[model samples]
Target: MVTDKDGYIHLVQYLTEHLGIFENSQQQSVTEDTVMELFEEQLAAQIIMVCGQNPSLTFSQRNLVVREVDSIVYDLEEILARVSGHKATAEQSVFISELSCLIKNLFDQEIARMISL
Candidate 1:
């Protein structure tokens, strides 16, 4: 679970340091829109962190990462589907799509390696 832990730490650090991306212009305000955006950004950060630590991960550990990514994808898809029916913006869709692709690619590569081995 080192990969997962590292991912979480990195995500938390990113969110804390990059408040502008996560918080509203009012500085203390956090609307539903901002919260959703921050969640997506955190997921992306976690995916990147896990991918970067993949080389150190065992097969079982890699599988765990795959499961984690799959869960995130499912959650993201549900949220996106709900939001799309509303008034979701192009930027939000693009960000989610890009992050989803990154997570999928990393998970696929690791899973393929495990199967080949």
Candidate 2:
């Protein structure tokens, strides 16, 4: 969203100052703070669920998934930060990691198949 100055300005204005989070916002029905809270709650829930289901892959295989997940999470974090106009919290980082691990698990067999080729 922050790909350019105009776009960045628009985003910041909309999310930070214009999203009804501030008194200047004309629409108070939905604030940025409320939306952020909802997202946080959902992210926390996803992380909890995923972390509860630990993968049974080997050390090397699991680590490889983790590494790839990290890369994806980093990009996700960057995009989220831009959209929210805030840095990612530690909890969010954990959520991302757990989500990544779960995704890796889902594709573990496929990855193993490809690796054996």
Candidate 3:
């Protein structure tokens, strides 16, 4: 259901770049939780795009979709944490790529489920 598959790669890149910023900054106002929240919002936006402003959806339907999205985000936190902590060795990079694909699949499945409902 993801119209743009490449967006997953971009999401990973965005996460890494922002993580680097937080790591290098001396005055650290931005916490990892803040970064994760922003990432989660971006992810939720992509997954929820299938709804496309359909005002007919009931509150329960919207809540169900959101809960599924939250589940996907929770499952992805381990990969995100690894990406944040690692120095990016070749093996780790490959692992991260695999994890990225898994993340994409999770999002796709959720989007498909939302569309079907």
Best by TM-score: 3
Model 2, position 116, has a per-residue lDDT of 64
Please provide TM-scores, in order, for all candidate models, with all chains considered together: 0.37, 0.34, 0.40
lDDT of 2 by residue, 6-85 (tens): 53334334433332322222333333343234444544454344334444545675565445444534444454444443
Residue pairs whose backbone atoms clash in candidate 3: none
**How much is 103 displaced in model 2, in angstroms?**
4.9
For model 1, the stretches where C-alpha displacement exceeds 4 angstroms are 1-66, 70-87
- For model 3, the local distance difference test gives 0.50
- Model 3: what TM-score? 0.40
Tens digits of per-residue lDDT, candidate 1, 1-117, equal: 322445444543443453333222334332344445545555667666655755666667756775675566455455444332233344444444454455545455655676467
Candidate 3 off by > 4 Å: 1-38, 84-117
Q: Comparing 2 and 3 by TM-score, which wins?
A: 3
Error of 1 at 16 (Å): 8.2
**TM-score of candidate 1 on Cα atoms, chains taken together:** 0.37
RMSD of 1: 9.2
Q: Local error of candidate 1 at 63, Å?
A: 8.4
Tens digit per residue, CA lDDT, model 3, 7-43: 5556556555545443443443333434345556555
Q: Runs in model 2 with CA error above 4 Å?
A: 1-56, 84-109, 112-117
